[model samples]
Target: MSSAMFARDVPFERSPTTDLPVLLPPRPRERFGWPKLTTRHALLFAALVLVAAGAAFAQAPDAPPAPASEALTTAPATPLSVVVKWAPLLLKGFIFNIVISVAAMTLGTITGLMLGLGQISQNTIVRRLSWFFTQFFRNSPWLVLLFFAMFMIPFQVRIFGTTIPLPDWMKAIVGFALPVMANVSELLRGAIRSIPSGQWEAAESLAFSRTKTIWQIILPQCVKRMLPPWMNLYSLITMATVLASIVGVGEMLTLTAQVHAAEGGRPELFAPLYGFAGLCFFLYCYPISKLTQRLERRYNVKT
Candidate 1:
């Protein structure tokens, strides 16, 4: 055959009849919009487990009790024996501690309310004086102030009667309360300030006096805000009773100290004494703390 005939016979032709769907790789299709867990994620998971393990490993192994610090080591008192013999005495101290907390909380609350009002009072003089009182009491250490009140106040014959023989418990009550008053005062003051100015204006427009507006409108709002702080203050008051122990007030802590002295500082006896004392502290404060937290959440919604 000729070359042209061969070329004609070996023909190349193109046709258009496509109807197939485009396909992607299975790797991307299998994911279906899911994110890939990279090496970073695996490393993060490993690091978290390591951190937890390291934390557990870091704690020192507890050793057997040393004899030197044994409670009642030198004729130290035993826990069981102290419970049998001295429970009643310790209970009296516990009651005194409760009394101090109650008295201080109630009186301090009243004083705090007054100071809170003083902060917003129209009288500049009253406000200035209130500020000074709040600053002084809030900043001063309770122990120093109490010592001064108990031992030094008599020299000046300033407030409490000069000839009066104040009980150790009472002295502590007043001294600790002075600071708590300042604390509550500040809480109430902040709450009062937070109330919208529009509320006061509305009350005034309705012909209400300043005192009447506060009593009716402002106090309710302040009270709600005060609940958590007040409970916190109560806990502080409970702890503050420990200071009374130092002044020979015979509170729980003092009783525990007495037991400790009698125990000859044995770890077993002393540990349990202070442990029980610590437990008492928890008993008094824990419920209040829980209640405060609850009220905070509740009142936050209400306000």
Candidate 2:
């Protein structure tokens, strides 16, 4: 082929004025469509909708005005003032809820890690027992578990001649942790199983012990796969902390009710106070959920 033909086929274009090859800028990657709508945006939109609905309901027509003397004597406190005054107390209870969630998650994760390993063990008895407990707790209702923990567990126990108090909140933590442990166990089992069997065979070929293979090779790979789901589970646990209130643990919802009663039980304050509690939870969990999504995308593996 002539040099002229090779020149004509060159990737770069020749400069018209100087007769020298000009390098073209690389083409930009094409994006397919509109920007993705994220979870945060969806949450904010839902919050706005709730706010609008609450405002409309608050402005709904009221009963006819009371007699002037009665109205002057019985005027209820403004809803804004009531919420603002009680927000700090409500926040303390909310912090307690966060503490319960963190404790439960920690306890659950540690226990679940052991259970997950058990499920994958070569011994038949250990595997079966781990599977049974995982299935039992995973399928049970959360509230029922809370009630069980509350009634069945003792109020206190003595160990080494020392009496230890077992408070309602501690029982509540146990209740929440049961299901979380089971779920984590399942998550881990699934993540480990998702790894290719070739990995196990390759480790065997290298004469690596099964335990060493799992710890050094298998589990490390599973971590990326497990993280996104684990974070999602944490968010769920955080939200479910509110359920502790039903069992008489003074979480945010319970405190909200007390605040309403303390503020004379004005019917108008009920919605706003509970709404405020929901908003707090939304604020805390939303970031976690957004991070989980990003991690899922970043760690996504193509088949």
Compared with the true structure, what per-residue lDDT tens digits does model 2 show for residues 139-205? 9999999899999999999999999999999999999999989999999999899999999999999
Worst 10 residues of 2 by lDDT: 28-37
TM-score per candidate, chains pooled = 0.69, 0.81
lDDT of 1 by residue, 1-303 (tens): 675575565543333455432333344322122234579867865675455445433532444666766634644333556665867777777878898889988888889788978978889999999989998888999888778767854433335654555576677777777888899889988888888889999999999998899999989978888788888888987887788877777788887887767755544455445555665676567767767776777678333
Model 2: CA > 4 A from native: 1-74
Question: Could you tell me the C-alpha RMSD of candidate 2 in Å?
Answer: 6.9
Best by TM-score: 2
Misplaced by over 4 Å in model 1 are 1-78, 155-164, 264-267, 301-303
Model 2, 138: alpha-carbon shift in Å?
Answer: 0.3
Pick the lDDT winner: 2
Kindly give the number of clashing pairs for every candidate: 9, 0
Cα lDDT of candidate 1 equals 0.74
